[model samples]
Target: MLMEELPPEAMLDGPPPDADHLLQRTLGTVREERHQAVLRRGRITAITSTFMVAGVLAGGVWLGHGPLVGGTDDEGEVLQGTSSAGANMAVKVTETEGGLRLVATVHGVPDGAACWLVVHTKDGRSFTAGSWRAHAGEVTLAGSAMVRAGDVAGVSVVDHDRRPLVTAG
Candidate 1:
């Protein structure tokens, strides 16, 4: 009955030596530890790669659709005017980091005519924002000036001779 409980190999020579048993158990433990280490390393690599991809995608989105120069509200204020020569003008002013940015568009201007844009403040201050040649159908011009926010009160379009052609609030 006792011999039936023992394996055929263990039945030989009163069983295997303790050294062989210890060596086999130790090798099994080492293999298990090695497998666990490999799994831990794989998990760490996967997590790091996921975070790196997410960071790159976030940065791309920020650079693509981020805020403009002065933050929101690209179109600040639009001023409409009609010149004595029947030309219609529109000017838009928006805030910027340093000062202000102005855009002027004029329609029905005579060809070869020089025109300028003037920005006026509430404190009776004026500045020539920009100038351009007036076209027959339309003329567009842009400029920038250093001024505080909410300081501008009006805008004016002038002819080549510095004559005020149109004014608007």
Candidate 2:
């Protein structure tokens, strides 16, 4: 007698061994490659960003420290302050209609007192600009210092003995 074929009901209890686990593994490799690519891009971006920041800082420092035409550093400005260096004197050197001129003014004088304008040149010459015997409770003088490049003109308030009370810078 021929062997009777098993009924289809016998196969209904289980699935076939046809699942593609190899395909899942290949997909996992693809995902890992994609993740590595993203990491590489991020590293490159960070390096480039660091370089850009350093460049900006260096440029700023150079411009601030480098000397340029018509540019004066802090030291130069301090030396130029108040027009001269002497007693608490303040002078203004300007070019007026007559040419280079200097004007000196002093205030806070004693009531009913007087003051004089003293002018000195770097060339060992001294002259008096003008004198005022306390007018309007203030003393002021106008004088010109010899104009020389890099030269300073000083104006100072003088007392009875020609002693500088407050020298103009």
Candidate 3:
């Protein structure tokens, strides 16, 4: 029955049956057209699905985990360096969301003023992080950038305080 939906082959075994010849011709043409339309629709659907899948894959790749930079702190063994955070510079690193969050208490920067966080990995990979302006007591740096595995994550300021400021713990 499904094959009946398809157009018959052009080759006839012998002389073509004369029964309803014209009607059969019309039906054949219509059937062939319907089959062609179905095929075209199927191709379009396949193409659309492929594109959707590709988009999801590309997005997943782009959303891959960011490199993490973290080190174990012993508090006492670590050196509490001067804050690059300016005046009342008090930089605190806390464990939040399985990542080290750098929070600073500075006196100079005003609310809405942009502040840049410079981070460095153990492999010497350094990059600027998402900016955070002074909000209330401190500015929150981005939390998504993970601390590199088996390495220390260092943080500093730009053009303000370059004092190798890291409290080694």
Candidate 4:
């Protein structure tokens, strides 16, 4: 084989073999790709957060209106009463497992007055449902009676001294 050697000046010839432009192009492409990746991550995070908030709101609505939290409608029979002393009482009676449940809303009674709820049965017997201390505005109290709801002939509220405050049948 024949060997030929080029002069050193030939290597240093034209544009100094520029590589800065190639390096800049490579760096610019890498920077653009990084920016695009960051944008994609931000978009994904925003979408996921929106869905999570929507799901939480839907669950809250379902819980609020569901039967587990008690339906919106009032249940049982409602009775009203007003006494000569100007006291008023409203009672809602519902039949329960072995007796009757009562929710009473009493008004126009003196504050801090001890009151009792008495239930009279059709069989000529009286039963005390519960008692409480009256407060301002409408006072709501809950009680239960051993008698069935249908057997209740009347209901009354009395003071600690047994003076009738209100009565309803």
| lDDT (Cα, 0-100) at 97 in candidate 4 | 58
Q: What clash count goes with each model?
A: 0, 7, 11, 0
Best by lDDT: 4
lDDT of 2 by residue, 1-169 (tens): 2335867667575555544676678899999999999999999999999999999999999764444224333222111122232324445555332323445555555545556766655675556666777544333455543344244455456766787666654
For all the candidates, what are their Cα RMSDs to the real structure?
A: 10.6, 14.6, 12.4, 7.8
Model 2 CA deviation exceeding 4 Å by range: 1-89, 95-100, 135-140, 145-150
Candidate 1 Cα misplacement greater than 4 A, ranges: 1-70, 73-75
Residue pairs whose backbone atoms clash in candidate 2: 84-169, 89-167, 89-168, 89-169, 90-168, 90-169, 155-168
Task: Give residue 55's error in model 2 in angstroms.
Answer: 63
Worst 10 residues of 1 by lDDT: 64-73
So what's the TM-score on candidate 2? 0.38
Off by over 4 Å in 4: 1-74
Q: Whose lDDT is higher: candidate 2's or candidate 3's? A: 2
Candidate 1 lDDT (Cα, 0 to 1): 0.80
Per-residue accuracy of model 1 over 1-169 as CA lDDT, tens digit each? 8878987787577545797888899999999999999999999999999999999999998764435465675657788888677878888777776777777887876777787888889999888888887766777788877876599888888787877877777
Any idea what lDDT model 3 has?
Answer: 0.52
Off by over 4 Å in 3: 1-21, 24-36, 47-59, 66-110, 120-127, 132-169
